[model samples]
Target: MFAADAASRALGIRLLASGPGSATAAVVVTETMLNGQGSTHGGHVFLLADTAFAVACNAAFSPTVAAAASITFLAPTGLGDELVAEAVERVRQGRSGICDVTVRCGDRVVAEFRGNSREVHPRAQRPE
Candidate 1:
């Protein structure tokens, strides 16, 4: 069981108090995450969302891996504008699960992400 705070800390994400997923974790956009235009880079946003997904999935299953993932950039995020990413479990089947994630800043959604993950036994915990 991964507490929300621990999950956020593990992923280097911060929890925001407002937004679509306000009560959830959001990645703080920094200068190092900017692109040539000084806007948040798409890869950086994706990584943030991906990290959230990793924590969400693995928190329950111990070990999980992303099987498929995609993100659509809707708007640009500037430096210092906290980029919030949220992951909600959509469906689960056996050892596989699907999550719908969204990244936003204030009222503007920066990106939408969907991730498919597979739960696997940890290498050290593998059965003989």
Candidate 2:
């Protein structure tokens, strides 16, 4: 899944590691990623977290997509900051699951993301 993620790749997102129900990704803040105040834009942070969430949810080979997601920005980051996002599956029941992603620059937490995922492929659905 991460291998085919064009959007994430375009923003210089690199998949660091992944395993069953978990993933880690990183991106460097670039000049183009900054906002008016010279801080990294929230969208970029969200994308980093979203990418990690996508990888974690899709680790099982079943196509999954985010049904809903939200993020909270705790700190500001700027150009040259290497942001790392770690995603972990919090819950999975049937075809629905929840994942949490934490974006950090070094030891400082920059953002927290929560994603609600739903398996889109029929093969992932439980038989009645």
Candidate 3:
């Protein structure tokens, strides 16, 4: 799934590792990712966290999509800063799951994200 994610790839997000219910990814903040205040855009940070959450949710499942997600920007990052996002599954029951992602720049926390996921059944993939 990571290999096929063009949006993540386009943003230079690298999948560092993944397991049954966890994933780690990283990206370098670039000039294009900056906001007018000379800091990395919040969307970029969310994207990185979301990518890790996506990988973790799909790691041991057939397929899943985020039912809902929210993020809190704890700190700002700037150009050339390397950010890493680690996502861990908090709970999973039936077709619903919850995951949390922590985005960091080295030892400093940059953001926190929580994602609610729902498995996409094969039947749902069929064209109506």
Best by TM-score: 3
Question: What ranking of all candidate models by TM-score puts the best one first?
Answer: 3, 2, 1
Clashing pairs in 3: none
Lowest lDDT sum, 10 consecutive residues, model 1, at 15-24
RMSD (Å) of each candidate, 1 decimal: 4.9, 4.0, 2.0
| Number of backbone-clashing residue pairs for each candidate, in the order shown | 0, 0, 0
Give each model a TM-score.
0.78, 0.94, 0.95
Superposed by TM-score, candidate 1 places the C-alpha of residue 6 at a distance from the truth, in angstroms, of 13
- Candidate 1 clashing pairs, residues 3+ apart or interchain: none
For 1-128, candidate 1 gives per-residue lDDT tens digits of 23544644654566433222112467777777789988988887887787667666765555678999999999988878888777877777898988878887998888999999898876775567
Candidate 3: where are CA atoms >4 Å away? 124-128
47 Cα displacement, candidate 2 (Å) = 0.2
Q: What is the per-residue lDDT of model 3 for residues 20-125, given as tens digits with 9 covering 90 to 100?
A: 9899999999999999999999999999999999999999997899999999999999999999999999999999999999999999998999999999876655
Give me the displacement of residue 35 in model 3, in angstroms.
0.3
Of models 2 and 3, which has the larger TM-score?
A: 3
- Among all windows of 10 consecutive residues in model 2, the one with the lowest summed lDDT is 119-128
